[model samples]
Target: MTDNALAYRRSHAFRTAVTDIGGHQRFTRAYRPQTNGKAERFNRTLAEEWAYAQPFTNSHERTAALPGFLHNYNHHRAHSALNGQPPITRLNNFAGH
Candidate 1:
């Protein structure tokens, strides 16, 4: 309803999808990537390592491979900030620890 909310609805697929699934919509200010710094960094890493490291033969092949890359990134890769734990592990025990 606000300008920022309308902007989010127009811009981001994940936000739009979540809203469609009965989630409430809110908006963070523009130019405030620090608010979601971890996700922003992960996205940069994904783009650098997986998406644009080399030329994809086609868009379909790139799209098809993204889930596997994401799975490995979340489940296997150690993050220094997490004290060397993978994201999946951290997520599973997030509140407990």
Candidate 2:
């Protein structure tokens, strides 16, 4: 889900990618801050822990680091909302775990 950003609404590539992934695109409603809280929190966390965690020489370098960051976030980092467990801890029958 995203806020009502014009780019998301207008970008064909974005829409196509979402569809290709079998995902549905949703927009947060205006004046409903609670509806966007999780997404906003995730954005903030992503920026703080990955996007700006270190200096990168180029966009490619930053882009290449995303998977590793995501893996660590999902498998290692503790979350208060998860009762201080990593996100993976909540998964039942997670393959190869």
Candidate 3:
């Protein structure tokens, strides 16, 4: 699956990875937001809660902070749909314990 980012959509590396993985080349609907609803929602949450929560002087600082934000989001934040478990817990198959 791919987002609408121009760089991601057009990058040689991204295309090569998808092809190597046996994925077909298809584009998400241009104007239909529902086509990628899950990703859209995640992007919204990330932007509101992490990306735009504070002012960064430059892109470098924001990029540097992304790993910490992702780590915390995956390991600390609880999801109601996941029965209050962290994403990493589910991904690592340790949610029930």
**Which candidate ranks first by TM-score, i.e. highest?**
2
Q: Encode model 3's per-residue lDDT on 23-71: one tens digit a residue.
A: 6666667677777786677788789877898999998998888878887
- Clashes (candidate 1): 0
Each candidate structure's TM-score, on Cα atoms with residue i matched to residue i, is 0.62, 0.72, 0.63
Question: Candidate 3: which stretches are off by over 4 Å?
Answer: 1-10, 15-35, 92-97
Candidate 1 per-residue C-alpha lDDT over 11-91 given as tens digits, one digit per residue, 9 for 90 to 100 = 778577767856666554566666456556766898997899778999998888887887777788788988988777756
Candidate 2 lDDT by residue in tens digits, 1-92: 88888998899999999899677999998889987897799899999989999999999999999889988888988899999888888888
Task: Evaluate all candidate structures by whole-model CA lDDT and list the values in order.
Answer: 0.71, 0.88, 0.77
Tell me which of candidates 1 and 3 scores higher on TM-score: 3
Q: Output the lDDT of residue 50, model 1.
A: 89
Highest lDDT, which number? 2
Question: Ranking under lDDT, best-scoring first?
Answer: 2, 3, 1
